[model samples]
Target: MHEINWLPFWLTIKLASITTFLLLLIGILLSYYLAYNRHKINTIIEALLSLPLVLPPTVLGFYLLILFNKQGLIGTLWYKIFNKQLVFHFEGLVVASVIYSLPMMVHPLTAGFRSVPKNLIEASFTLGKSRLETLIRVILPNMKASILTGIVLSFAHTVGEFGVAVMVGGNIEGETRVVSIAIYSAVESMDYKTAHIYALILFFMSFLTLLALYFLNKKWKPYDKA
Candidate 1:
């Protein structure tokens, strides 16, 4: 019988949940700008936003580590304010996961916002609805599928995070040892059984998430057309 350690799995859930929640709010604002803004710098901003999608996790984590180090800008500021180190903490993991999974949230949301009919937006403005009101009442309601996809993708991506998590947060057992790092440590210790269990759980979770997204999109296609 393989003994499963639930701590890492639970911790992964906690991290993914918090990351996804924060990303949802940030993603909506950023995506709205990217989708509608015609500024020349929009292209450059979009490229930077999408960098994480292509960048290696370890590479991103390395830079984040520097940024969150005691001597680093963000770290120094945080230390001065909180008198606590940002590196190797759960809060650090949350920050790392947010940065690492941002594109997953932003891309789909931008597409969704762009897909909203321009006429409907204009009509909303004509009816005295502010940009924020139109965004809340018209745009988001029409892009349910895309919003759901972004949330699911962001959550799953955060759950599967390893390189960044390990780099920034380190393997501090219950503190920062999420499922990905747990699997890595298990394998390194030749505990194939434990590693397999962790790997299988993540595999199924990711697979199901994508599956749900596809199914929901299909179901919503007719409504979206109407």
Candidate 2:
């Protein structure tokens, strides 16, 4: 029997954490714009953003690989500035994760924003509050459930990412060897015991995450403290 290496699990958690944080920030701004604006172009933009949800992970990962390869445009610029390659690096994994998990975060935030009372937003504006202030003080406070849902979904999605992470970041140990990849490697090596253990852990983690989300949604009233 072989002792399990816990590094991959830690790496997966780190990736998920970073991905969720970036997606939250990006999701907020994008969701806010999409929620309030009415324009033909916005529809096109929304569709592009949502493509990840339906696109195959490998397809998205392949595009990212091309875009961030040593000779690729973005890759070249990053290499010139950072003096290192993006492919097969931890940073590349983060970028890939943000893109892959974007819709998970944005969809919920957009729904939350739209669910807010339009009159409440107008009143905040009429009271001389800035859009930013209104968003922080009013809109966000009322959209707790949506925000929570987005964060959880993005985190969970990033944790389970395999095809995209492998294609963009490769399975470099201690860099991009996330738990999902670890499980695959174990299976390939005929280490069924290790793979089973990893799979069980992931199953429990995902289950608990979703269970907590549902529980919180049931208990966390948006205006309870307001």
Please provide, for model 1 over 137-223, each residue's C-alpha lDDT reduced to its tens digit, 9 standing for 90 to 100. 988999998899999999999998889999999998888999999999999999999998889988998898889889999998765
lDDT of 2 by residue, 13-102 (tens): 999999999999999999999999999999898999999999999999999999999999889999999998999999999999999999
TM-score of every candidate relative to the true structure: 0.96, 0.96
Off by over 4 Å in 2: 221-226
Q: Where does candidate 2 clash, by residue pair?
A: none
Best by lDDT: 2
C-alpha lDDT of candidate 2 relative to the true structure: 0.94
Worst 10 residues of 2 by lDDT: 217-226
